[model samples]
Target: MADLESGEGKTPVIDIPEAVGVFDTFEDLQQAFYDLRMIGIHHSDISLLANEKVLKEKLGKAYWRASDLEDDPRAPRAHFVSEEATGELEGAIAGGFFFVGSYIAMAAMLTPASTLAASIAAIAIGGSPSAVIGILLARRVGKHHKDYYTNQIEHGGILLWVRLRDKEREEMAVKIMEGHSGRDVHVHSWSK
Candidate 1:
């Protein structure tokens, strides 16, 4: 299938580096996953999907996985990814907006405090169960934000991308991707 897809309008591209530079290491990536309660996705499906060989041979692996609920070891549709095609997963997590934590926040709410003193007590002892409750309440306001944004990004149907700050470098990368497989690689930027 042609990677360069278009219908009524042009699709926007996103840069990877600018998206992930907020983090310096994989540990930071792990924290984001933990905060979002998304570590499990990474540990299970995402990890298996990221194998390098798997990515190249079965670029649509995850899409296929979503088509069926049951596993069939011998199924012909199985995406047999190899070991060498691993993408820099750390990059994807860093560049992509992690949203599960935000989802949790939106779904949960706080009960009003019966008295100001209890609320004050909760604030004074941060990390106390009461304080934890307060944090959860705060999260209720911001929780839906992350999940919403992440969904939009993923809805773009792009798993990995590169962000080039320099125009020349950006063109070079696009040219390279075009040369490689005519895969219709795209360049992304914050400016939109």
Candidate 2:
């Protein structure tokens, strides 16, 4: 147990080997559990699997209790997606394309399409700026809210958790989990 503290009043960065999925509601969490299972991703209830001593010592008693779901089976099981299966990364990249595509379509429609080359040129020109801005904006949002999301999970809003197979899988997992997640999805390396 190294010093988990990273900053004052911040959730100590525990060395965990899991990705936690945070959702706003219990239904969303449950749905994710079933959805992942459908795709053959083995998942387990974190509350049932977490080491009580490590949880209590690192995250505090409140989080420990929050992680526990044995007392109430009806309550959402804080799911931990295993290091298997896959998630969509194309969605994030496609979002950038879609955002830019809309403007390109509108511009092409409003202006005269005298030639296919002209239309193509308009799309290329318009799309470059829009795509850059869209991707940057998305990245900014993630950077700005990273802390807020981490705090939310610390305060017991974490609805699900997963241990990705690797970094690439983690990236994809974030996108997929974020799609279903109500609040946020975070990847952490938790020592067993």
Candidate 3:
């Protein structure tokens, strides 16, 4: 099927057929995302509703629902980050802290007056705060993501957009979304 869809009269040309859905919770949305991937949907082809700032700036709306953006090409998109990616980020953060502490400990050990025990103590002391700070920062990252979903839920439900080229893929997308308890799962004539 042609990626670019054209129809007569008042029908704006769309780049591709797109499926959209509203998920009541983040878990449902996440599950649909994974399932869509299993069916050969590219990661870049899936998008969540953009944040309030984007909605306001682009669509001039403080709030919107899945239906509102079903056919609108100007709707903004948000990137999806997998749980594994978030975990990796958290690990990187904590590991970075440890590396810094080790570096500092090594610097202290270079001093003529510093002994092995003192160096060890330096590592423990410096590392403790670094580790603590890192954990806190990582927690903040996790919380920020959680808050994003919560905020969206409060406004309505989580809106998901799946872009596809063919009718078969579009149907699969709609079914996958609906199976995950998606509300208003539908296909549009176009996508951004």
Top candidate, metric lDDT = 3
Candidates ranked, most accurate by lDDT first: 3, 2, 1
Candidate 1: worst-modelled 10 consecutive residues by lDDT: 69-78
- The parts of candidate 2 lying over 4 Å away from their true place are 1-16, 45-156
Candidate with more favorable, higher TM-score: 1 or 3: 3
Per-residue lDDT tens digits for candidate 3, residues 1-192, read 324332322433456878888888888888999999999999999988777787888667766765666556666789888777888998899889878977888788899999889999988888888888888988898888888888788777888888897888888889999999999887866776
Report the lDDT tens digits of candidate 1 across residue range 1-192: 112223324434333221111122233323333432221222221111133234335343444331231111111221212112223332333223233333333233233533566545434442344334544554543444334333423433212223345666556544543443322345333311
lDDT of 2 by residue, 69-177 (tens): 2222223322343212212233365476656676875678566544777776777777777677666665665543344334534656644555555576566556666
Best-to-worst order by TM-score is 3, 2, 1
lDDT for every model?
0.31, 0.50, 0.81
Clash count for each candidate, listed in order shown: 11, 8, 0
Of the candidates numbered 2 and 3, which has the greater lDDT value?
3
Clashing pairs in 3: none
Q: Give candidate 3's error at residue 32 in angstroms.
A: 0.6
**TM-score, candidate number 3:** 0.86
